[model samples]
Target: MTTVALLDYGSGNLRSAERAIAATGAETIVTADPGTVLAADGLVVPGVGAFAACMEGLRAVNGPRLIGSRLAGGRPVLGICVGMQVLFDRGVEFAEGIHAPEAADEAGEAAPQAVGAPGCGEWPGTVERLDAAVLPHMGWNTVEVALGSRLFAGLDPNERYYFVHSYAARRWELTDTGRIAAPLVHWAEHDGCRFVAAVENGPLWATQFHPEKSGAAGAALLRNWVATLD
Candidate 1:
């Protein structure tokens, strides 16, 4: 059986994410312990609230190394919402609650604030702030997955799912399927902006939308995530 590690970083939407993963019948371990994470077959990092605060939690629990190890080991990892963005190099722009123009005033140019923490990343992907669409990108929107990914398993062509995010990924390429230890589907575009809806770099599958809140199509997506372990 697939051992799915449902990470609980104190303030998180633990129960719902757990239910989504559990529906796949994988063993779900929701805890603050890093050791439990290291031992798991698959890892799910689910988060809500501010980005900086979550990073603090990930650091306090020694999640940096724990998660990095899993990613390096090619263990399946799933990141949702803020969890998805966390995998990037850094999100100083959003974390500071400032826009690019404002950030430019702070620095010479629009640059991400580098965190001194060990586990925190520099936010490898890009961040797209769309003006035409509403902020948070709330409600249902169609997700045009890159192509051929476990995250989009059993999904019909041109499927739609719910979303809620003000910022979207500015850049992220689809992982080379062959070398993907935690493969990802990257930077799906909607309303002229590309966003990282789901990413699989090998064993990891991360999405910005809440699969648990996505209903039937989401349930099928979760099942697909489970199938990858087989």
Candidate 2:
């Protein structure tokens, strides 16, 4: 059996995530120990909170420095939601209202001019304001899956998954050449501007949607994730 370590960072939707993975018949362990993480067959860094809190929690639980080494060992590592955002060097969040949109616009413009932009941090890309039909993008929405990722296994392109978040990842357009993979984007309209809804890179997959809220299709997706364990 592939051992899965659900890194407990004090707060998150752990019970639901645990139940989803368990449906796949894999063993799950909630842990705050670094040794437990390093010994696992695969690691899942799950989170639901501010970016700074998530980062601090990871450090607190696993000494802050173990993440890179544990993840880089080639063992499968999955970061769900905020956990996924942390996989990048940094992320854009709404902790500060001042960061709502104008900040994103300024960051967008400064990317080319500055080697490193302020609000966007060191993400190797820039952030943009999402123009979705509704803001905070709650309820159910379907993702246009990127075929071959295995993350979307057993799900259709039009299938709607549950979401309850205001911020989404939109850091690709401003990226320098070779900095971004063939990015995957989902959409909605807010402020008459369209923006990225999700992103995936090699060995890393994340989404703002909570599978636990998505019903059977979501459960199957979690199972598919478990099945991929070597």
Candidate 3:
């Protein structure tokens, strides 16, 4: 049986994610143990809340290192929502406050701390707040999925997925050198701003939308991911 670890780092809709993955006929365990996470056939990192807080929780259990180890060994790792954001180099939301120095020098001058939430750096880019008229682009939306994408295989190009987010990777920064396959990026528009919706880069897959809440289409995507585990 293919076992998937639903990482529990004090964030995300844990039960819902676990149920969704389990519905794909895979053995799903919602755990925070590094051993269990590392040993699983696949790892799912699901997060909901502020990026900084989620990173703190993830670091608490050394989730980033676990993910790195898995990816280094060619193991699959899936991330959703803020889970995806933390995979990048950094996130700009609440950046100023999170990285602010706790104390000032004797001259009473506060030193400028580094900006943005430090991420796992699996992908290069920063998750910044969307420049949309309406905050939190919440609803069902379709993505411009790339062709021949294993993650979007068998799914219609017009299929809509559930989304609820205020921040996203507005621009993709990875370039395709002759050395590696270029990352497949999908874009979606909300209030006239186009942002990255899904990404497929080798063993790492992520979506800004909530697949577990996306109904039938979502289930199909989850099943597709499980099918790849074989």
- The lDDT leader among the candidates is 3
Predicted candidate 1 versus true structure: per-residue lDDT over 1-230, tens digit per residue:
78888877764789998888888888888986778887888888887766667778888887767787887777777888878777776554343443445445677765545332222462354444543343557787777666667678668866777787766566664344457154445555566676677766666667888888899989898888877876
Report lDDT (Cα) of residue 196, candidate 2: 47
Worst 10 residues of 2 by lDDT: 113-122
Off by over 4 Å in 2: 94-123, 126-133, 173-200
User: Would you list the rank order by lDDT, best first?
Assistant: 3, 1, 2
Give residue 166's lDDT in candidate 3 (0 to 100): 84
* Ranking of candidates on TM-score, top first: 3, 1, 2
Superposition TM-score, candidate 3 onto the true structure: 0.89
Q: Which ranges in model 3 have alpha carbons more than 4 Å from their true place? A: 95-115, 176-180
Model 2 error, position 27 (Å): 0.5
Cα lDDT, all candidates: 0.71, 0.60, 0.89
Report the number of the highest-TM-score candidate. Answer: 3
Better of 1 and 3 by lDDT: 3
lDDT of 2 by residue, 1-230 (tens): 87888888775788888877777778889887778877877677777756667777776665245556664565566666666556555545554432345545777833222121122121344332254545565687656565555777667778887766555455454244233355444443344544444554444445667776689887887776677776
| TM-score, per-candidate, Cα-based | 0.81, 0.75, 0.89
